[model samples]
Target: MAAKQVKSRQRVADHGEVFTAEREVKAMCDLVKQETERIDSRFLEPACGDGNFLVEILTRKLAIVKKKYKRSAYDWERNSLLALGSMYGVDILLDNAKACRDRLYEIWEQEYKAVCKKECNDDTRAAARFILERNIVCGNALTLFCVDNEQQDTTEPIVFSEWTFPFNDARIQRKDYTFAELINAEEPKRPKKEGAQQTLFDLYPEAKPEPDEEGIFLQQYITHYRRLSENG
Candidate 1:
């Protein structure tokens, strides 16, 4: 059974679906680096089956910092680790989660070796492990519970947290927001404007409207705007 399981995972890896290759990973990292201007950008991989995206992100971020500051390689390396916090991930499978964390630490170890110009000790490896264990949590990405349908309330936005585009409208007091909260907020009515308007309730109207229909509808609008902002 163990062997068969290994083979199955290998097949998945070969299909270029689960464990990503170094080159493709590098490409993804490059795209993120180019598009984002956040000094320490945060990235989240919703279905992070094995942390491939997060590892790749760390590699690119580390390289960027190293190029900018060559002299203080140690400090740069620490900064790179700190930057990993910005790179979030979520995986349902426990084994996959562990593997993902191990791969990230391995990448960190390799980077540390290259930066320090010397072999990394157990202490350094332990430090990397510590961070990985703390950050990589096992939980359902869509485990939000609606405490009050009308009001804006959620356990917390996890891996799938989204942001929306900017609004030139001065009427919108809160320009930015999240999809979940927006769908749950009290939008009495559609803003007196015309443009792209998509709602979760529209997608799943039968899913059961919250007690306070207005609050939840308006909340949905806020969430929609927030998601657009993030993508924009």
Candidate 2:
């Protein structure tokens, strides 16, 4: 049977909670086949209801991770985290947000335990959960703000984390930007002294990143991949 698309009439009335069918979800995902298969391409669903769309995207990313990195548990673990980190979701319903996070973790954990069995560690698992927690949000996408249990808007604006292994090392870096900032992001026009071309690092040095827009960040954190749970 097809997966149930509607949870209940009450939910539909309250939040318009109708989930996309698996068949339609897959067909839509196929339209972006190459990006879906790219291990680190980022995807965000403004209204992810229990992650039907995000789950399918993650599944595709994990399959690519497994195919390329399965031989070595180390490679598998790191790439899997990268795949998981790249997905993002937001839902107005708090229950839906929480459920989405759990659903994502369960899927990641099942694949993780199957592939990395003896080599798996709690820290890595926790890191995966942390990524889901940060990536999935209980918020009003329309208002660009977070929401409380009663489905009312909260004072806090919606913020999303950008994760990357900045260096070719085990450490991961996270920088937070408001949903508005990202949506409004544009290339900064540069000034030239007539004959000069400049390297990117000249403007954005390694020690300091010069964002095009001021106040684009809320906070930043860095930690070893396995130890990411400790920081955020």
Cα error, candidate 1, residue 232 (Å): 37
Residue-by-residue lDDT tens digits, candidate 2, 1-232: 8879998999999889999999999999999999999999999999999999889999999999989988888888888999999999999998899999998898899999889889989999999999999999999988778899898988777878888888767777777778876787442222322324222343335624556354656566667789888774
Winning candidate number (lDDT): 2
Worst window of 10 by summed lDDT in candidate 2:
190-199
RMSD of 2: 7.6
| lDDT (C-alpha) at residue 205 in model 1 | 55
lDDT of 1 by residue, 1-232 (tens): 1112232765466422345566676676667666333436767675576787787677777777667655675455445545554555656556666887888877777777777665345544554565466456454445422222332334534212212222322111112223234445332222422435444445445433346532232233322221322211
The TM-scores of all predictions, comma-separated, are 0.50, 0.88
